[model samples]
Target chain A: MTTMMLVPGFDRVVELVPGERAVAIRNIPATLPVFATHFARFPVLPGVLLLESMADLAKAALGDGHWRLRTVRGVRFRHFVGPGDQVEIRVEVTGRTDQTAQVRATARVEERVVATARGLALVAAEQPWEGTQ
Target chain B: MRFHLIDRIESWTPREQITARKVTSVAEDCWRPTPAGPVLSFGLALEALCQSATWLMMLSTDYRLRAALLAVDEACAPRDVVPGDVLRTHAVVESMSDEAAVLAGLVTVGGETVLEASGILCSLMDAERLDDPADTALMGRQLLGKGAPR
Candidate 1:
């Protein structure tokens, strides 16, 4: 996708969880210009963006900022979220190694599961994205 | 690894969101050895359109919300889009309430719609309902400093 698609001015932050999980909340305001033109009638959040929320949760859980996804499994989407609905993201590591981890994740709205995915990723022993800066 | 580029948002009137053309080159990257041939993948095409909507909305409202595709949804590829065929992607914002928004998009070639799909994005997070604090600490530090954004 073009860099143009990346969210601008939007903010993301990680929060505390019950155990070893990490949570982050992002709010998509209704006034966003994309909606004004998405269509004359039918408008919905892009599927890729929903998938990215899963990735964002995984990124938050890994702690290390730089890692590429190797595989994704058991991904299923059930519900739809719109301007007012809050996307609740939950991600935890099912297993891990120095270089990789198996993560179990879920997206929800008000106790309802919107989507779920199992992710396999290659992680670095150290913070790789940090070195770049 | 292989990367596919999506379309751009040309303009957005009050009625509809305009998507620019998306192009995928057939060159083999270091990770992907085989050329992708003349047509681009349908999944990627739909992704490009959704990406376009996210950016357009953010730019128009001057707010940043992060999320990506949640599913394949109802995407259909009726025809092949070649390397040269400019896939013009389009989507409309159905409704926006609170912080979540929905955009439905279409990919077209020569005015004929080639693919269709939908996207749903949300804009709220509850700090109390997150995963483990220890696991989220490092990412939290990088994200919202000490106190998570309330």
Candidate 2:
């Protein structure tokens, strides 16, 4: 299993639509040091973290080979997701070429939409330090 | 509660523009892998843009309104930024209203545009909600920089 170094805790793959899409769940831990400083009283999860969660699921949908995000469009963040929330992330492969693929993704807390994004993902050779295991 | 996304304001023009920089540190990075070469994630770059826009909004409102990022469009990061790279972010206010403001932001390293976006920032609260307006203004001044003594 390839680990998500950029966005950790992406191991929970709930449903795989096979070759086209995937759904995963990640729990936001309240203990994140960010909460202590990000509006200490409110403690809402940063929007960037929410976006990263969706990007991680997009990577899982791509499956295999190193990839990079090239473009993200029409990202709309709705509800505020806070600590201890279990976010369900879904990603659908929209288009692809030999070197790149397009994906539309969303993050939800139950039925409430937390965020959505559409972006291009490109396959690239593993960075030399990634190691050939 | 400051996130410190922007280490220090490099330049500021009240309601018109702002430029800042943040260098990636292991303690602030989510990734820890060799060979990956200190990659800065796209999401983090976008956050830096939004943070800069937030400051522009706060300054324009005299620190009276606290804005939250409402939407991002055409956000493109053509290249990745390494750990040691100085991520310089520049934000220019396109327009502003009582409820929201539009901003054009670009992030660069060594004068090359690595990431760019057009984002909307909407005020979630204003001085009318705060008991002490001075407290908010104080923070506003801290971010906008002190004015010359009269």
Candidate 3:
């Protein structure tokens, strides 16, 4: 995939309890072009990319549907993720409704908490995007 | 692709606030396939706002300090941004210190609020660590259209 496809789909799902919790892992490759421009010399995964990974994992746990991120609250970047770092992303569904779902997410590297969000709200799209069917 | 998110600086009020523009393009790498359609990633949209806020902080410090996003207290994107949409972001400094600053950002499309964020904390650092002074100065000037013709 090109550098634009930033999430770099999860390599493995350790556990997934639909409507409850999900755990997944992704290994950051040293070659991602994003590392070059994010900081030409000092390379680290962008914090936004970590949030996107959490969002993607939330979608996986929520099942087949168009889940669009609506809001994020209390997100903190505690540590930097660098090349060769394996990130484990965890998401827990805190609440849900017909129109939206609320989740809390965290990312860790080698048992050290790297990033977290207290709440992420996702809205369900009524229809799938064209050509995705 | 270069990660420069803000396309241009529309206005600036020193340390108070800054308004910037971003015109999405289909050629940009940020587009991702979604169930509804390919849409601009919300993270990128947020990044744009952060970049804009960074600019404000940088200018406020006379380019002597660089800002790094540290935390987001709250953020919301109510509308999906598609390719070709022009986004206007206004970032207001809510608080600042020698080492950090908290800013609020709002993004709109055609006068409609699409995204809003508050309590964005950015840590200020020495500018030389992230970029050369001369280059950063040039970028600031270009973004403000300092030398461009009408």
Give candidate 3's error at residue A116 in angstroms.
Answer: 0.6
List candidate 3 segments past 4 Å from native. A1-8, A128-133, B147-150
Q: What DockQ does each candidate score versus the true complex, computed on alpha carbons?
A: 0.05, 0.43, 0.46
lDDT (10s digit) by residue, model 3, range A15-88 = 88777888888989988878776766567788888998999988877765678898999999999898999999
For model 1, how does the per-residue alpha-carbon lDDT over A15-122 read when each residue is reduced to its tens digit? Answer: 533224666555666664544433223344444456656655565566643444434555566676666767777778777666777777787778898877655343
True contacts kept of each: 0.07, 0.54, 0.56
Error of 2 at A101 (Å): 1.0
lDDT of 3 by residue, B1-150 (tens): 577889899999988999999998888888888766678777888988999999998898899987888899999998878888899999999989889999999988888777899999999888778777787888888899895333
lDDT tens digits by residue: candidate 1, B7-125: 34455553236566665444522111112223443335656676566545544443333224444334445555554566677778776543556667787877887777654443422
Supply candidate 3's per-residue lDDT for B18.
96
- lDDT string for model 2 (A1-133, tens) is 3332333456477776544788788887888777775654566777877777776667667766666776788888788887888888888988776567788888889878888886645445356522212
Provide the TM-score of chain A alone for each candidate, in the order shown.
Answer: 0.70, 0.81, 0.88
TM-score of each: 0.43, 0.83, 0.91
Error of 1 at B116 (Å): 19
Model 1 residue A8 CA deviation in Å: 11
- Please tell me which predicted candidate would have the highest TM-score against the true structure: 3
Q: With candidate 1 superimposed using the best TM-score fit, by how many Å does residue A81's alpha carbon deviate from the native?
A: 1.3
